[model samples]
Target: MNPIDRISRRINTLIQLPENKEVIFITDLRKEYRQDLKNFIFGETLAVKDGKIVIGKNLYKRWLQKIKTKGFDYDVKFI
Candidate 1:
């Protein structure tokens, strides 16, 4: 599967997003990245609103950390 698809699935498992919506919002992201760590997620996923990604939060922080460590291999540019 595509890397983005994997990320999407992971996010879905963490937080149930509306199936009808094509794009998730920054409002859906975790409080940390949504508020303070904004740059960490800027272009990692598709953006819909002002600067939100098409994803949500992860209480486990497992995939979130994986993304930060290995996201570059998936073409995610972190600054």
Candidate 2:
């Protein structure tokens, strides 16, 4: 399969959380792929709920800060 299809397949495998439910948590923004988060169309805040996933502005900001500090250095498993 093509690379895009491969990535799509991998992403599809992760769409459902361990609970076997569609992931609605903002923490699900973490990705296994090392590609820039800004380029990811579906996993970012902007894509979730068409930008309605707002818990709080500070909450989102803190989330971003945590991600940056933790760094996207390892593959993320949805479990």
Candidate 3:
């Protein structure tokens, strides 16, 4: 498995978030992890519709690169 897969798997396991979920409510997250999730989503063009954050198709790829280059250091599982 690749690093990207490892990171993505960690995200899925932690959040159970799907790309087609439409929106991810900020309220659904623990306050401490909100910033980390925000940072991760900031990698791509972010959209908020009806008070939910949108997940773009390229988010995982961008986040993967960020992780590989040490751009994103937050441990999703720990956050």
Candidate 4:
């Protein structure tokens, strides 16, 4: 799958955890690159508590910025 699709899938899986549960995970968004080398990079974990979602990395900030620039409002939170 594409990078965006992979990321989306990962996010979806992460959000499926119970409210008090912590998700310790890893991912590889890259299918293949540079002489067929698989770039299986580590991804951040996430947790949900008290109706709020917390992300361990600022990567999702870019998506938030895009939404803001487009004058759209979304309910997304990342720690």
Candidate 5:
């Protein structure tokens, strides 16, 4: 699938993850979608672990909001 589709699929799986692990990397977040991340407003909803950027639940929600604002859609909300 395309990067955006993959991301949407991955985000859809966040609901199945443990409450403490509902996170994703900005890089892998888009993967092949090639979406810009330089201006992403992560604020304090993320954490860096083992050199990989990990975002938290709030950030995940914000990520969805950003995507939706851009006209993206999903059958369910994972975060």
Candidate 6:
């Protein structure tokens, strides 16, 4: 599979699953990762809302953050 699918599946596997959910609260994340998640991941079909996965944060807030940190390093993941 491709990198996006690989990353998404890896993250999904880390979840408790079948009951418990996996939520990524981006409040504590650095500005760079947030922007990539908001722009690259969330902005694309890589993110689906049909599962027990939720990246908590408003789209507007994410956009504001991206603008605030414009030109920062992108293509980052939550390491």
Clashing pairs in 2: none
**How close to the true structure is residue 3 of candidate 3, measured as C-alpha lDDT?**
80
TM for candidate 4 is 0.25
**Candidate 3, superposed: residue stretches over 4 Å from native:** 1-33, 40-44, 68-71, 75-79
- Scored by lDDT, the top model is 3
Residue 14 in candidate 3, Cα distance off native in Å: 6.2
Ranking by lDDT: 3, 5, 1, 6, 2, 4
Overall local distance difference test of candidate 1: 0.47
Task: Residues 5-67, candidate 3: write the lDDT tens digits.
Answer: 875665564345444454555555555456665777765677776777655545644544565
Which of 3 and 6 is ahead in lDDT? 3
TM-score of 6: 0.27
TM per candidate: 0.28, 0.27, 0.40, 0.25, 0.44, 0.27
> lDDT value for candidate 4?
0.36
Instruction: Provide the overall lDDT of each model, using Cα atoms, as 2-decimal numbers.
Output: 0.47, 0.45, 0.56, 0.36, 0.52, 0.46
For model 1, residues 4-46, the per-residue Cα lDDT tens digits are 8876665564344444445556565444334433555455544
Model 4 Cα lDDT, one tens digit per residue, 1-79: 6777875664554344323344321222121211111111124345655554454334334433444465224233221
With a 3 Å backbone cut-off (N, CA, C), the pairs that clash in candidate 5 are none
RMSD values for the candidates in order, in angstroms, are 11.7, 11.3, 6.4, 13.0, 7.3, 11.4
**Colliding pairs, model 3:** none
Instruction: Give the alpha carbon lDDT tens digit for every residue of 1-62 in model 6.
Output: 78888756644533323124334544334454455555534543334355523454344345
For candidate 2, lDDT tens digit of each residue in 1-79? 6777876566554333333533344455444442433332235344346553423344444444555577444455543
